[model samples]
Target: MSKNRYSVGLIIVIVGIILLLGKLGVFGFVWGLFWPVFVLAPGLLLHFLYFNRVLPSAVLIPGGILVTCSILFFLCTIFGWSLMAYIWPGFIFAIAVGLYEFYTFDKYSPRGTLMAAVVLAILSGILFGVTILFTVGIYLIALVLIGVGAYIIFGKRRSW
Candidate 1:
């Protein structure tokens, strides 16, 4: 009887605390910032499962994609959505990461998947560079070129 009474008392206290926290809006604040952890947790769990040999290595494909994309999402959320324009190629890079993980962990260790991963990685790199060049990077590149040209025109020529 005392045990039952104690349990009921603990439950009432816990419910009171939860109600107080909810009324204070802590849930909203925490959810807004940490929602992506929902996405990241399953990916990490899949990785943990595979590493523990409880699941097949194939799970790594989705695991890698989820983990990578979650990190990217977290970065965008923390910084600003505008950064997505500069970093959109990261989606392609996420696929490459998934394929690379699958290639790495699979028993067959297929070469084709590795090649695909490499190609996707290189493509993502090229796209990322091009996107940068089209955005703020153009101004930076122009500034560098102008500085070099000004030095060449105004400074004495050195014998090489």
Candidate 2:
């Protein structure tokens, strides 16, 4: 009769059905694909609790981080794990997202929260650039050099 009981019952029934379907091969592809949702759901629940005023706004930080990490995890699952080498910057960006969310939502946020968020975002960008450069090898450097050369040739000259 209580909300908790109803929620538990619903969850049990849904899980039971899913297991049944899995045994029957009805969810062959979907069964394996959705495992990351388990990691993502808790993050979403935290955000929902924060919005509903059941939890403090501070929850946004971990919630954002978890959600971002879960998405990246899912990507790693779908793509090859080798992609993780280049995508590791996502972990830094996840923290940045969490910090930014906390800064935006917490009225009494710490003084350096915004600064920390900005720094983390910049660090994430730098890491991502470095990763791309490493992954792409000399091509990226050549492209940059060509762009610089084109700028020097065609860019407007300014008087100093």
The digit string of per-residue lDDT tens for model 1 on 64-131 reads: 99999999889988998899998999999999999999998896977699999999999999999999
What is the C-alpha lDDT profile of model 2 across 52-153, one tens digit per residue? Answer: 999999999999999999999899889968889999999999999999999999989999999999999999999999889888969977989999999999
For model 1, the stretches where C-alpha displacement exceeds 4 angstroms are 1-10, 149-154, 157-160
The lDDT of model 1 is: 0.92
What is the clash count for each candidate, in the order shown?
A: 0, 0
Highest TM-score against the true fold, candidate: 1
